[model samples]
Target: MKIMNPSLDISWTHCGDGDDARYGKSVKRKVDRVESDGRKVLLDTNDSAFDFIPTAEPSPGTIEDK
Candidate 1:
């Protein structure tokens, strides 16, 4: 991965061994990652919404906790 602009670009690469590349179904499989040279991937989760609930009004003889 690399920082080229306001965002980052990522890539993937994989190869097989022992004549596995002949059939194209290589024994090696690469997964999508933020780093290619075996480095830690920094990522954060984003919440799409705010969760808030309004409290009910106190009744004539109801007690509320502060």
Candidate 2:
């Protein structure tokens, strides 16, 4: 199904990537929100696994940092 309102809603947050991913296996994620059929949900590949992060290409904003 095609998405209607595709946005990322960050539920919680931490300082930044100043730490490692396995640091207590706890890290903050920049949450993404996706809506469908009047239902809202959080979507973040990082939450799935650090492995997913590799598959993600940097977004425009991230490119600016480089």
Question: Of the candidates shown, which would achieve the greatest TM-score relative to the real structure?
Answer: 2
Every candidate's lDDT:
0.30, 0.34
The total number of steric clashes, by the backbone 3 Å criterion, in model 1 comes to 0
Tens digit per residue, CA lDDT, model 1, 1-64: 5534422323323333346433433222122244567653433222111111122232443222
Q: Residue pairs in steric clash, candidate 2?
A: 7-33, 8-32, 8-33
**Alpha-carbon shift of residue 60 in model 2 (angstroms):** 32
Q: What's the number of clashes in each of the models?
A: 0, 3
Model 1 regions more than 4 Å off? 1-34, 48-66
Q: Considering only N, C-alpha and C atoms within 3 Å, which residue pairs clash in candidate 1?
A: none
